[model samples]
Target: MMNHSMSAATNVMKTVIYIVCIFFAVLSIFPFWIMFMNATRGTFEIQQNSIAFFPSTHLISNFKILTGKSFNPLVGFMNSMLISSGATFCAVYFSSLTAFALVAYSWKMRQPFFTFIMAVLMIPAQVSGIGFYQFMYRIGWTNSLWPLILPAIASPAVVFFMRQYLLATLSLDVVNSARIDGSGEFATFNRIILPIMKPAMATQAIFSFVFSWNELFRPLILLTDNEKYTMPIMVSLLRGDIYKTEYGSVYLGLSLTVLPLFIIYFLLSKYIIEGVALGSIKE
Candidate 1:
């Protein structure tokens, strides 16, 4: 009788957990659904009951007005892609090298350097936001993609993330074995460590790419030339001249911007999940 009662309780708990999970999942996805629905209907129609839940036929017409050669969204998309991709590449490369140095090598200042890096990581990069803007303006890079790409190369979060992952997944014994086999630190990292870190690096790559791609504030203030605008900047400026808001085109723009991230997450979800799990668990 006791065993049967316990079994029933366990099953009840499992069902409750499942229900809670589904509730949160729906909560998370509700915004995306709303955004998509809002994109389909005219702004006025969004307030309507039935139309709010259904797809409207204005999507194609809205898309034309959005990409209508005059307000070229493609240009912004291209710029954002270049800047984000380039930044991700550099961030991964440099951060891996730094993490390897901090982990594999024993030096007097190693702990201090790590501490400093962590401190920098703790403070929001936006603390010096004003100074950075002034400096960029002084240089010719204010109206360029360099402003978007350069700051991320020295990302503190990347450094911290790689450091934590290296400590957790990478054993000193394996690294030393590679060294004993006459491998230089850089070569060991490139051939051995990099392969092992593929999952973590992939995770970081997605984050860096998405954050950079969706970034608006930095690009908005820095780049004045319409030709050099990033995706978010272009989309934000897509507000209607005649209408107060073009709900369809705005939703379309959002969909286009988010589509790449969705594809990337879908394809590499297993790797990203593994990487995050491994990195978060301390050995």
Candidate 2:
């Protein structure tokens, strides 16, 4: 009788947990569903009723209105893709390399250097924006994507995360073994360490990509040409005037802008779970 009561209690607990999960899941997805539904409805319909439960037939019309504006979704998409991909690659690869150095070597200034990086991390990016913009302006890189892409190499946050991940997972015995086997440092890192760090790298890559894609401040301040504007910039521009704003078109642009983020998140989500789980375990 005790065992039966315990089993019943466990089953009831699981059912309650499942119900809570489903409720939160619906809450999470509700906004995106409304946004897509609004994207399909007419502007007047959206103004009349913002919370749309069903899709309408105004998708093509909304696209037409969105395209009538100065912004080109295709161009914005391409520019964002280029910047985000370059930034993600540089951030992940260089951060991983820096983390490897910090973990695998016994340099004298290792702790101090790591401390300096932590200091830099504490200093917010907005604090350095003016100095950064001035330097970029002096070098004539303000209008170019180079300013956005190259700065990612020194991402203190990514470096910090990678360092912690390496400390949790890296083994110095493996490094010594590779060194004894006549493997060059670069070769060992590229061939052995990178594969081991794949889960962490993928997780960080997703974050970096999403950050770059959604970035608006630097691009808005630096990019003078509409041709170089990212998706966020274009989407922001879609709201020209509050009174004349086409709600349907704006929602459509937002839905389009967010599509790639969803794709990136889905592609790398598995690695995120693995990276978090592995980072939590200490061997």
Candidate 3:
């Protein structure tokens, strides 16, 4: 009788937890759904109705308005893709490499170096924006994507995450074995360490990519040429006069901007979930 009662209570608890999770999931997705719905509405309808759950038939019209004379979404999309892709690649690969070196190799300054990196992680990038922009301007890279892409190679946050992940998953014995087998350091990192770090890499890659794609302030300050503007910058420029703002067009651009992030998440979400689950289990 006692076991049966305990089992019943456990089931009830599980059901309640499931209900709460579903409720929060719906709440999270509701805003995105409304944004998408509003993309298919006219400026007047969007202003009048404000909140809508159902999609309208004005999607084509909204797209027309969005891509009309002044804006070229294709250029923005391509620029964002290039910058985000380069930044994500640099952040993931270099961070993992730095983490591997710190974890696998013994050196005198390793702890101090790691401590310095952590200190850097606490300092926001915006703190050095003036110096960074001045340096970029002096180098004549103000309108170039290199200024945006190159500094990501030293991402302290990614280094921290990669180091933590290596601490949990990487084994020194494997490194020793590879060295004993005459494997080069770079070869071992590329062939052995990287494959083991796939889940963590994917997780960080998604975050880095999304962050680079959505970043606006740096691009706004650096990019004077319209052709060099990223998606977020272009989207920001959609704001017209207060009385004549095109709400539908703005929402349409937003919806389009969100699409690539969705695709990236969909491609890597399984790895993200697996990485989180495995980390939890390990802990």
Candidate 4:
């Protein structure tokens, strides 16, 4: 009966793993439940009683208070949209361009150039924050959205990720064949390889969008004007005395800010994760 014992042991292990997974899932969902409950209760209602589980009824009122006339949450959302989209578009295009150039070229110093790019990728974003701020300020771009837009045109993370994927996926024979077929360099990239790089591009686009959308420190420092405030900025503005702090409104604002990211992840998360995993695994 050793075989029977072994099967029983395997079943026990499987059951244990499944139970552990369920526990973790519940743990992860607990915060989201709390946030939703908080969003659906008045700032004072929560203080009055200990109500747990699904929220009662206060989402619409909370949203109204959070999106007040003075704050104009919609304006903030629009600003974030413009900035994030601009940054994502620029970052993806240039990263792809850099990847293609590094892969297709055969210069004497190609290896060294690539090594430098890789080195840049290793540096943290904060390391360059001071320099970037100063550079923007000196150029009279500090108060405008252009500073945010300009910095994203050259993303080291995008370049490195794209380079790794291109080295794996892109074929030299395709480039040579394109050249032989009277396709110009620009035409070859624009027409041929770009479509194939969709997985990587989509991944980068989602990343850049999220990064820009959630960015607070840079925008806080650079964008001093209230008119150009992004979602993060607007979220930060929800602060006051202990009693005056609108926790319900804050929760509503948080949920509103999170909706776009949720949409993006919902749409592209599977392919993005697959692309990254495949690229890393093969490498």
Candidate 5:
């Protein structure tokens, strides 16, 4: 009788947990559903009923309006793709290299260098925005994508995350073994360490990509030419004024802006799960 009651209580608890999970899942998906639905609706309809769940037949119309304005979806997509991809590559590769150096090499200044990186990470980007922009301007890099892409190499946050990941996952024995086998530092890093760090790299790649994709302030400040405008800037431009803002077109543009992020997340989501699982395991 006690066993049966315990079983029943366990079942009840699981059911409650499942219910809670489903509820939160729906809550998380609700905003994306509304945004996509609103992209298909007319501005008047959206303004009238903002919480609409049903999709409308005005998708083409919204697209037409978006294109009729200064927004070029294709150009914006290509530019954002280029910038974000470049930034992600620089951030992940360099950060991983830096972390590997900190972990694999025994140097006098290693801890101090890491502490400096942590110090930089604690400093917000906005704090140095003015100085960074001035430096870029002085270098004649303003209105260019170089400033946006190249600076990602020195990403303190990525460095910190990679260092922590390396600390947890990396084994110096492996490094020494590679050395004993006559593997060059770069060769071991590229061939062995990189493969071992794949899950963590993918996780950070997704984050860095999404961050660069959604970035606006830096691009807006550094770039003046419309040809260099990113997706976020294009979306911002869609809002002409309070009175003339086309809600449908703006939503459509926003939906387009967010599509790549969803694609990237889905592609790298498995790595995130793997990273979490790997981190949980004990030697």
Candidate 6:
């Protein structure tokens, strides 16, 4: 009788938990569903009915408006892809390398160097915005993608995350073994360390890619040409004037911008889950 009672209680608890999870999952997906629905709705329909769960019939019209004369979603998509991909690549690889150096090498000033990086991490990017822009301007990189792409190499946050991941996963004995085997430092890092860091790298790569893709301030500040504008900037431009603001088109643009991130997350979600689970256990 007691065993049956306990089994019934356990089933009840699981049912309650599943209900809560389903509720939260719906809540999380509600916004994206609304966005997609709004993308298909006309301006008047959107204005009349604020929260649409069902898609409307104006998708083609909205797309036409969004891709009309003023803004080109294709161009914005390409530019964002280039900048985000470049930044993510540099941020992950270089941060991993830096973290590896700090963790594996017992060199003089290593602690101080790590300390310096941590200190920089505490300093918000906005605080150094003026100086960075000035330096870029002086170097004649204004109106260039290089300014957006190159600074990612020194991402303090990525460095910190990589450091924690390396501390948790990397064994100095393995690194030393590779070195003792006469492997070149770069080769060892590229061939051995990189594969080991894949999960952590994938996790950070998603973050870095999303960040760069959605970033507007720096891109708006640095880029003068309309052709070089990122998706966020183009979306912002959708709200020029009250009369000109095609609400449906704006939502369509937003939906388009969000689509790539969804695809990317879907592709790398397994790694992200693994990284989180592994990192949490390590911690």
Per-residue lDDT for 1-283 in model 5, tens only?
A: 9999999999999999999999999999999998999999998898888988889999999999888878888989989999999999999999999999999899999999988997787676688899999999998999889889998999888877787789989999998999999999999999999999887788788778888998988998888888888999987786777316688888888899889878866877787677556544534
- For model 5 the TM-score comes to 0.84
- lDDT by residue (1-283, candidate 4, tens digit) is 9999999999999999999999999998787777778888887887776356878688888878776634567888899999999999999988898889988889898889778876786676677789888988998987788888877878877888888878889989999999999999999998998997887898888778888999998898888888889988877676544315677877777777777877887788797687567546523
| Per-residue error (Å), model 3, residue 177 | 2.9
All models: lDDT?
Answer: 0.78, 0.87, 0.86, 0.81, 0.87, 0.86
True-vs-predicted CA distance for residue 194, candidate 3, Å: 1.5
The window of 10 residues in a row where model 2 has the poorest summed lDDT is 274-283
Clashes of 2: 0
Candidate 2: stretches off by over 4 Å: 1-24, 242-245, 270-283
Q: Per-residue error at 105 for model 3, in Å?
A: 1.1
Name the regions of candidate 4 deviating beyond 4 angstroms: 275-283
**Model 3 misplacement above 4 A:** 1-26, 242-245, 266-283
List residue ranges in candidate 5 displaced over 4 A.
1-24, 242-245, 273-283
Q: TM-score of every model?
A: 0.82, 0.85, 0.84, 0.89, 0.84, 0.85
**Which residue pairs collide, candidate 5?**
none
Flag clash pairs in model 1.
none
**Superposition error at 126 for model 2 (Å):** 0.7
Candidate 1 C-alpha lDDT tens digits along 100-202: 8888789999999988987787676577778888988888678878777777768777877888878878888998898789998778889998988776688
Which is the better candidate, 4 or 5, if ranked by lDDT? 5
For model 5 the local lDDT of residue 78 reads 88
Clashes of each: 0, 0, 0, 0, 0, 0
- Pick the TM-score winner: 4
C-alpha positional error of residue 244 in candidate 2 after TM-score superposition, expressed in Å? 2.5
* Candidate 2 structure lDDT: 0.87
User: For candidate 1, which ten residues in a row score worst on lDDT?
Assistant: 43-52
Question: lDDT, candidate 5, residue 109?
Answer: 99
Report model 3's TM-score to 2 decimal places: 0.84
